[model samples]
Target: MNGTLTTALAAGLGTGLALIVAIGAQNAFVLRQGILREHVAAVVAICALSDVVLIGLGIAGVGGVVRLWPAALTVVAILGSAFLLTYAALAARRALNPSAMPMSENATTRGRRAVAATCLALTWLNPHVYLDTVLMLGSVGNGFGDLRWWFAAGAALGSLLWFTALGYGARLLSGLFTRRRSWRILDGLIAVIMATLGIGMLTNALR
Candidate 1:
């Protein structure tokens, strides 16, 4: 690629990776699944592909149509908050009930369908995601003039690589997660993250 396109690609990759490679409910879930070694591929695929689709829509300016309807974001905000808070409660319960969990392979796991649905919910329900991928990324892409598609491709690739690394690389932590106390700590952290995000969303929507 030419220097300009390469610049756009690098910018997109850096921006996208910066946004996604941090603490979030989705990352928490993926990390947990990775530690469990259950449905890791499916979870990673869902996150990566969903990001690509959302990024594509944003680059195409579907976000403009979304802006014309404030009610839509408001509705999504409310729903997302509720979903996150509910998930937080569940995670708290798991934290408190650590005795019920074991890291053994034969231990019960969430069914593939259930995990997929939750993965979708966690991905699609968050308003912050729309702001990040749609509005923010779109604005950045537009700043590139004619090379925006190259930028979009880089952003999408960054997301895919990050999720793949996070989901699969979590196996390295299997040793730590093998302990029940570690599981409790993880669940507690997830609870806190989810609750914070949920309350933040709810308050913003109410305003």
Candidate 2:
């Protein structure tokens, strides 16, 4: 309500969005789900909720604990890489197989449970989420002193808005994806993004 609060909130909003708008495995997955019109709500909710929790923890200084335990992140990095690579392979196969596109007659809708699990893994398993939301946002929020809660709220709101728009707004573009080549291009992009992130994680974790 105060000037400080407003400033912190705005700062948090801009910062939060900037971090999430980057090209990454999570965004790619969400975009894919959105375009397919399959499990969009579930994917959006999972990603948004995960960001809120992480933002809260960061504001609460839990990033310190994470920093003290390097092995924890290493484990996550490894697991995340494996999951990403697996998803990449699937995506690549889809890109190469015309009948495998989600819009195809033979395409299958993944179960909600599977979609939820994949969303969770994409969100939580990535070490960059920890670094950006937990460490970066947490550090910045805490610097706000007593207004850190407002900052967190702003960040949380940003997450909710971003994922919601990305998930649902993707539908507007769904019409464009009806063509087989469109789906192929999308799947191919997803494959490259996921594989690059996976290999990067694996390389970082090993070193």
For candidate 2, lDDT tens digit of each residue in 151-204?
A: 999999999999999999998998899899999999999999999999999999
Give me the runs in candidate 1 sitting further than 4 Å from their true place.
104-107
Q: Could you tell me the lDDT of residue 129 within candidate 1? A: 86
RMSD over all Cα atoms, model 1: 1.5
- Provide TM-scores for the models: 0.96, 0.98
**What tens-digit string does per-residue lDDT give for candidate 1 at 1-207?**
789889999998998998899899999999989888899999999999999998888888877867788778889999999999999998898888865565644447789999999999999998878889988998888888889888999999999999999999999999998788898898899999999999999999999
| Collision pairs in model 1 | none
Clashing pairs in 2: none
lDDT of each: 0.90, 0.94
Cα miss at 47, model 1 (Å)? 0.5
For model 1, what is the error of residue 17's alpha carbon versus the real structure, in angstroms, after optimal superposition? 0.7
User: What RMSD does each model have against the real structure?
Assistant: 1.5, 0.7
